[model samples]
Target chain A: MRFQLTEDQTALRRATRDLLERRFGERERRAAAGGGSLDRALWRTLGDAGFFALCLPERDGGVGLGFPEAVLVFEEAGRALLTGPLIATLRAAGEVPGAASGETVVAAADGWTVEWLAAADVARPDTADAVAVRSVDPLTPLHRVARAARVDPVAVLLTAAEQLGTAVRVCELAVQHARTREQFGRPIGAFQAVQHLCAGLLVRAETARAAVYAAAVTGARTDIAAARLLADEAAVDGARDCLQVHGGMGFTWESEVHLHLKRAWVRAGRGGGGAAAEEALAAALTA
Target chain B: MDLSHTPEDEEFRARLRAWLATALPVLPPPPDPADWPARRARDLGWQRALYDAGYGELHWDASPTTRLIFLEETEAAGAPYVGANFVGLLHAGPTIAAEGTDGQRRRWLPPILRGEEVWCQGFSEPGAGSDLASLRTRARRDGDHYVVDGSKIWTSHAEVADWCELLVRTDPDAPRHRGISWLAMPMDAPGVTVRPLRTLAGSAEFAEVFLDGVRIPVANRVGAENDGWRVTMVTLSFERGTAFVGEVVACRRVLRELAAAARRDGRWDDAVLRRRLGRLNAEFLALWRLTQWNVSEAAAGGGVPGVGGSVFKLRYSHARQDLYDAAADVLGPGALDLDSPWVLDRLSSLSYTIAAGTSQIQRTIVAERMLGLPRGR
Candidate 1:
């Protein structure tokens, strides 16, 4: 009957948000945006904090929380726009011992392909030793590293969760822009046209969040596709609206808005594009 | 985090199932609306049987937990009961129980439980669907009766319903919402007329019911005077929640058929359709889970689903529409050909979004109430 987060979940969310704010603030995000790769330090910090281990079994050196709690954490990650091989690491961490403790990183094989593994700290393709990382969104910390593994539904669900987070953040950024950006001496949010756009973005974000969280809790294949579809739409449309809200500044490299847009574009296409997700959804629905 | 039911509840489910095995009769699928009366009678018969077996009033305080268990089990067993008289069982029953005097409940409850009566909602008029308070239905007091005069549109099952749980303006001087009063009126009462309205699905399931100087007994009133809006809201909320689960399950069955068809035709290889189907499946699962969540919550004595129900309704309507659209796309030219049985059934799925409440209206509800956004108007 209630959708509110439990106290532990709320605290976890707040702590995660605070951690991201402290370690990967706007300046750090900007720095990472201009960087060669994602911030490994932040990834390590998350690993140490058991972020990757949230959904793992208790016996697996993890918190053993359910999808709902994982959703809270992922949402916080999205809000922070923290970039790293976080999803891949988390997915791998669940399968391998000490993976969540920064001892290992696993990468997925599909959607994004991993190449040039010599420089990677560990390269286990389709195995526990290898974390496959794909460059679906090169801007983010995702990679197609060689890893020995089977395609995990949990991984797909987690990736969708991360995408949902990114979409929500994009919507928040768009709303903030609409509220502050002035046109004709009034806040653009006051304009009906702008408000509608922001409102649509908000709907997309909220719906996607709801769908994704529901999927996490239910672990239903159809719910997963719904979460993915909403997340995809939110990320893609939210980014577009953010750009619209930012106007000219959004197109520039200096603007984080463009970065979000870029990441969204990459994520939407990654793991499988809109077409793939849509087709799967159609099948699931009819099924 | 433990979503499992208590052992006692599990045992209850089992015992109820055993009882239903003997008490419940197997029935055919829903007949075409063309055979409206026959189908309606059959449905009523089934409902009466259930009521006789003590499966009617699940949540009423007088109804024991055993009765609730039986009702839940019947639902879980996927036994077809009745269709389209939901306004009575879910809404009228509860409202009368909560607000009606003992005499009123005694009069109405037994007939409803016995399936001797069918009730349709008389809330939305042509002018007021979402802005329900703006309804122009007037029911002025006259002696021991109220002289009702106004028309209610989108009255589902009006032609077949024995009675109506109607909302009308009782006091002209009161505020729009405040002036409303809910009364149960017999469909065959003098000055009452029902005109069928056909939907795109080619079903005359709804009607425009006209009330011209219809004298309704004061004893039919359920809730306080000029507080009909509250009663109507409670009814609508129930409509938005529990009342729709069976329908959703039925829709899911249809969706399954469509999927099987797609698979048989080897259309699963179509990448575009596959992705679309996947997403639809996901949305359906989320909705199904939400429905289960609501049911379990109520079983545990949680509050009415409030904003959560609104969110579910909004998403569900859209998802239902999306499912139909996906089916149409997959069915290709066959989708448009209503002469084909498959196409007709697929086309029927389109009504899900528009029937209970339009998707647009549900979205407005979600935005205004759930998100606290400015009214779109």
Candidate 2:
């Protein structure tokens, strides 16, 4: 009956938040947005810390936890705007052989060609002892040289989880901005228009969180699509609001908020878009 | 994480189902607005049969666990739940149990539990729907009774209800939300009239209840004078809790029906339709979990989670509307024709968003109470 996070989940979240703070701080996030890809050392650090391995069964050398725990981890990741092949790495960790041990990165190689992959140092093409990367989230460092399999709905759910994290992060940034940024001798958060926007962002974040958590618990494919739809909206909209709250700063490369928006836009297209997700949900509801 | 019930509970459910199967015939789905009276009568009969089987008093203190079992069983069976005078049983009954005199409980509880009395809430007037404290209903003490004069709208089941759990201003000079008294007023009293009002769905499920110089016995008073605001809040909490669980389950059934229809029409192949169904399915699942959390929390004697009810209500209502809109969009031309039974189902879903409370009000509640945001000007 308890909705609050368990001790293990709290530890996992705190550890993840601390690691993200140390590895992908505001300066590092700004650096990544400028040109660099996700730091591989940090990726390995998360793997070692068991963030990617949390969802796997205990028999698989993983900490068998539940969706609620996963939610806390992803939410913290979102707060840090820590970008990488998070969805691919997490999914691969659970199902893909040796992927959980940080040996491979799985990606979906459909709808886009896999040519020059970024962050190829930690992962490369055509080396048997090398990384087996699938070309998914091409914008991220998830590309392994192995032949990619067809994308599954599970991948959609993972992506949705990541998006949920990103949305919440953007929401936090927006709230912080509203509280600090001033206009007309008062914080902008005091203004009705700004307050309404922040309120709306909160609503979207909560709704999306509800959807994603439900999907994770039920392990239903339809629920995954639903979560994706909500997460997609939340991320895109939350980032938009973040930019709005930051005014011109949010529009520039110096601000990491737009990076979340871009990444979310790309992820929203992955698996499927709003139209496909909505159709599936509508059918399930009516059926 | 374990949602399953004990074997004893399962046995209780079996007995309830067996009893209901014998005592009541399976009712047809709710009919058109033109056939509402017949539908209402049939529903009332079903409720009576349930009461006879002791299923209607699930929330009553007679057997709290058994009452919970009743709700669980009714929900699992996909049965049309006890619908008549829901406000009475869920809100008024609890309020009386908590604050009413011993005589009040002894006299009122029996009729309410026996299906011998029907009750509607008289809190909202024409000008006092969301801002309920502004209600002008007056209940002046006269002898051993109170002379009540005011009107209450959006009173569901009022036409058939025997009484109303009403809130009235007992002291006009006191501050708003203060000096109010809660009373149990009989509907058939000297100056009471019920006029059915048709909703957008075309059903006259609610009524405008007019009370002019209606006399309520002093014994019928719930709580102390000028303490009605707190009493009303207690009642409203029930409205937001147990009563809401049944409604959410009912909405789930509708969503399931929509899913089935989509599958039947080969709409699953359409990406647009699939996405819509998927989203609705997800939202419904979330609402379902939220309900489970609410029930389990209450059962464990924990306070209701902050604004979680508002979250549930808002999501449920919005998802319901979205489900119907998607149904109509998928049905296309077929939806425009009321002659089609599917169209009627779609029409019924429209009321889900507006009924009980509007989506906007639910959001306001969530914002003001749950989020601790200042009220909108």
Candidate 3:
């Protein structure tokens, strides 16, 4: 009945948070946004740290933990807004050479689009003839493709995991902003409108976190589908709300709040769009 | 991270499930919330059967997990759960268990468990619903008996209850919250009258109990004379616990039903309808997860359910209402027709928004209590 993370999981989260805070501070995050492709060195660092190997078997040169541990790490990665083809490489663990080691970078391509293809040493192509295309997120580039295969469920779940992270991160960002940013005379959080918004954001994040964690633990398709749906809603809507909390300052390019919204927008479309997840969920509910 | 119960829990669940499978068929279904006498008769019989088998409030020392399993399995099996004795079992019983003397416990606990007596709550009054401590229900100590004079409104099952967990303004001069006292008053005593009050859904599950100088024994006072507010809080905690597990289990089934109905009505193809259903379910799962986290947190700290009560209650109540609202939305014009099965559920579920505490009050609690926001002007 216990839902609290084990000591190992909590430590893993703390380590992941510390690493990203050290590596991708506000300065590095701004620098890494050159053409929306993550820095190769940072990508290498993630790979070398066994981030991709978390769920892969130990014999296959992976950490051999499981989805729960993987989710815990992914949540932190999400919180830090560390962007890259993390989900793709993690999915390709044990199957693709150098994926678990970060020696080779992996890019993802659906039928018409690919992410991080220009920098990728290897590509998990949903298409055979993938042509790189521009993506909405400047932090992650996209590529067009000729043909593509169905996305893996694990990859989909990982996207959800990332979305869950962003959802939680944006919630904290909003609350932090609300608590500190004064308006009219007091902290905006002291105002009912701002307080209610923060409350709503908290609700969205917690609800999505609950679903995502449960899905990560069970790996049930229905749970994952629901998780993906809620996490996307939470991340996207949460980002928008966070932006609103930040006011005109949040709308400016200098503010990191907009980056979270852009990131949420990208993650929401990845793995599979809302339509794909919705179909599975509707079937499960109707069945 | 394991959500599933232990082997021992599974065994309890299994035995309870087996018992329910056999016992439920023997007892008739509850008539309706409004039909107090008939529903109570059946609920009492069913409860006594469960109590005889060492179920119900008889298992006072059961772990939180075990209690949850019992609730989950009972809902899944559609077994009767002594709904007729809700106040007696869930609130009054728990309050007495926590605050009563040894002799008082011996006298009250067994009858509640055995279903020989039903209990009603006499807390809210005409002028004091949410601001319950401002209650004017006066109870004057008159030579070993307290003469109660004010009326209690929204008292559930007052007509059928043999006793009431009464809150009275024992000391009007004291501060509002500090002046109240908790009493176990005999409902059949002289000068006591019950008038049924039907809700918008046409169910008389509540009553306005008029207490005109009804005498209560001095020994029946729970805690001290002016400490009734604290005792009343214990009863409300039990009321809050009532929402923890059953609603999740039941709402899941309702979601499934709504989905099936949507499909049958050819509304499943509508993307908007599908998304609405999906979103409802996602929130429902969130509510379920939140409940689990709350339960586990309580278990870990050996604390009664605290924190996130308002948040959890507010979210889950709306989710329940949204479920029915969506069902009706998918059903269209038929949703308005009384003949349609969805209509009653849709119409009846609005109570969720208002019952226990209104959503606004819940928000205030969340704002002031959980979020640490200052109290409103």
Candidate 4:
């Protein structure tokens, strides 16, 4: 009846965090986003490290892991706010020729929008003339894509895992800010208002993390739907509360808080979004 | 992360289920809410049956997974819960097992497992609810006895309890938190009074216990003098940690029944309500999974839940409230009827945010203890 990470899984998670912290810290993330294009070198580096090919068979020139491991890596990527066609490329690892090696950057259409479409080497359901759109999140470049489809459940679950990661990251950011940021001669964390907000954020993130991890394990459609719904809430709401904790500093472009908020907003719309997930869940329950 | 039960655990579950199937039908019906003595007898009888069947002591003696299975299977089978014996079995007994002396264990633990005694919590006072450390219930030491003279509010089952796990300020001069002591007060002692306190739900299941110098033996002290606060925290950890396992299962059952009622009443056709129910279904499912995560985490780390229990409690308290709110939606005007069990549950749900620990306190604990946030004065 264990529901915690095994020693091996914990080591995998730590390694992923270390890699992201070293290669995709705030400075590097902003640097890669400055030109509004995918960083090819970093993408290749991640692929070489088996971030994309984590679930692929060792016989097929890949790391032979599973969804649980993939979820952990993506969670780290989400925390680092690593942007690009990461989810699509990872999904295409085994099927697309160069995706597993990061030689090809794949982008998939999500409703009317697609991320990094211009920088992608291949588009899954080739769109008819994508127009570049100004993205709310600086790290993620988007284009107005003309096609959309009901995404696979695995894609939905992975999107949720990313949201869970963002949720967790923002919670830590909120707690850190609350502890160090002072107001009226004491840490703002000493105040109940800010403390309650930070506490609620942790609760939401943790609840969503449980749902996301369980979705990865169970692979049930209902579980995935619930995970997506909760993860979206956690990420979106957690970022907003984190900004509240940081006060004026959080609103500045230099602070990473806004990036998390924008990314959460963007991710909330991905993989059929909250409305779709809710409807799926509603149908399941009603049926 | 494996969630499957071992074959041995599965056998235990199967045996329990079979025993319950045969055992439940022959038992007398449950007593009314107002019938304290009858309720006590019925509850203790169920406990005794479990004791005789070798399923007693599972709360502390069994592995966490097995305990979880016991809770899940029992709740699923519509079996009687610990009921009036909750404080003794879930709270005091565990505290005693964890912290009591060998003699304390020998004297107290078996009677609790055998369902021969009942205990009520005497922690909350009229002057000290959330700020329990500030309780002014005084206990003065004399020769071999402590003369307790104070009052405790919200002491559940005090009217029928054989014992009361009482907290009193033993040293008025020391720091508020440091001056306390935990003592097991005999409820039948002279100068003790129990005044039934009616809840908002119109039930007098709890009482205001006033002790006008009730004498307790020195041997009844669970832990050292001036260390009651820490001892009380131990009991509270149990309250927050695994106390809600069976309740989570019960909530899931209530959710299913609400959905079925909604369908019967044509409330299922409403998209908004259906979506709400669906969302709640997802919420409870996640909470159940959260319970699994917590229980497993506890099992891995010395069988005591860490701060994660606060996280579970915070969300779960609201979820339980939200669940009853959804039931009201299904019931519509039918919800106004006090006779409905759903209506009664909706009323009972109001206390969850206030009981065990308030949601406000839970947030503070999560922030200060779990997140390492600076504590507020």
Separately for all candidates shown, the number of backbone clashes (residues 3 or more apart, or on different chains) is 49, 37, 10, 0
| Candidate 3 chain B lowest-lDDT run of ten | B368-377
Q: What DockQ, between 0 and 1, does each candidate earn?
A: 0.31, 0.32, 0.48, 0.71
Best by lDDT: 4
Q: What are the lDDT scores of the predictions, listed in order?
A: 0.69, 0.69, 0.79, 0.88
Error in Å for residue B112 of model 2: 1.9
Residues forming the 10-long window of minimal summed lDDT in candidate 2 chain B? B60-69
Flag regions of model 2 displaced more than 4 Å: A1-4, A55-60, A64-68, A91-117, A120-149, A175-196, A241-256, A272-287, B1-41, B52-54, B59-78, B255-271, B297-306, B342-357
lDDT of 3 by residue, A245-266 (tens): 8999999988888888888887
- Weakest lDDT window of 10 consecutive positions for candidate 1 chain B: B59-68
Q: Ten-residue segment with the worst summed lDDT in candidate 2 chain A?
A: A107-116
B162-185 per-residue lDDT for model 3 (tens digits): 899999998999989899999999
How displaced is residue B16 in candidate 4, in Å? 1.9
Model 4 chain B poorest 10 in a row by lDDT: B298-307
> TM per model?
0.84, 0.84, 0.93, 0.97
